[model samples]
Target: MTRTGPVEIDEQTQLAARLRLVVGRLHRRIRIDGRESVPPLQLSALVTVEQHGPMRLSELARREAVSAPTMSRVLSALDEQGLVIRTPDPNDARGVQIVLSDAGAAKLAEVRSHRTALVARRLGRLDDDERRRIADALPALEALLVDED
Candidate 1:
């Protein structure tokens, strides 16, 4: 629904009621479908390294919005699993940059594939018209993220 800068209470109330329930259910289901072999923090750290690797441990921690100590523990778990490695930073001899190992990339890909497959399988059960309606809502759904920082 179109609205000026701030969404009025009535419109927002209706939208929020519908969106919270649907989005929460999908999020939980998709999360369950992903791999649980690694702990959540470790898996998230591994994916972070894979996506924006060759970055300083401190930088990664900052990007993750986590304390340096907390991120260090996450990295330690990932390192022990051979999912990520810390290389000497090119710019600073005292600093280390985190990068995803080959195995880490593979694991991340596998987890993502499982999540995608689960969602696709569920969507496939919908009738053609139902599926079409969902497809039509994709743009609006995606647009929701644009408001986020």
Candidate 2:
């Protein structure tokens, strides 16, 4: 690639675009395999519960960047699928804390395993130096997504 502009787009920017394209293709392929996992936002909620332990519906909604009603609907669906359980919040009689059922945990584990295997296979094709670059960038990418507020 030739640097033709006053502001040169570095290798990092080009790699980011390539990574996005690869991710998009992988997501499409996964969907075609009848995986039918929850949407991105719902997956985030599942992860929040998994990482932070059970939380109230409103808290999950806030953390997931969705309206409370929308969270309610998502929880309802997950509940119907036996993926989540709602327990009365110990702190409040009227509130409920969403918790993952055993089934949900297993499902999440399976999905994560599948995704990891897919990425691992792709990375296996790359040279050691290329894989090392991605390994080095993981922390920076994670930091960029971290919430400081």
| After superposition, candidate 1 runs with Cα above 4 Å error | 1-8, 147-149
Each candidate's clash count = 0, 0
Q: Distance from true position, residue 103, model 2, in Å?
A: 0.8
lDDT per residue as tens, model 1, 1-149: 76555557778888889999999999887887764687777777777777775898788888788999999888888888888888898898998888988988888888888888998999999999999999999999899889656
lDDT at position 146, candidate 1:
91
Q: Local error of candidate 2 at 144, Å?
A: 3.1
Best by TM-score: 1
**Pairs with steric clashes in candidate 2:** none
State the C-alpha lDDT per candidate: 0.84, 0.83
lDDT of 2 at 94: 91
- lDDT score for candidate 1 against the true structure: 0.84
What local lDDT does model 1 show for residue 97?
88
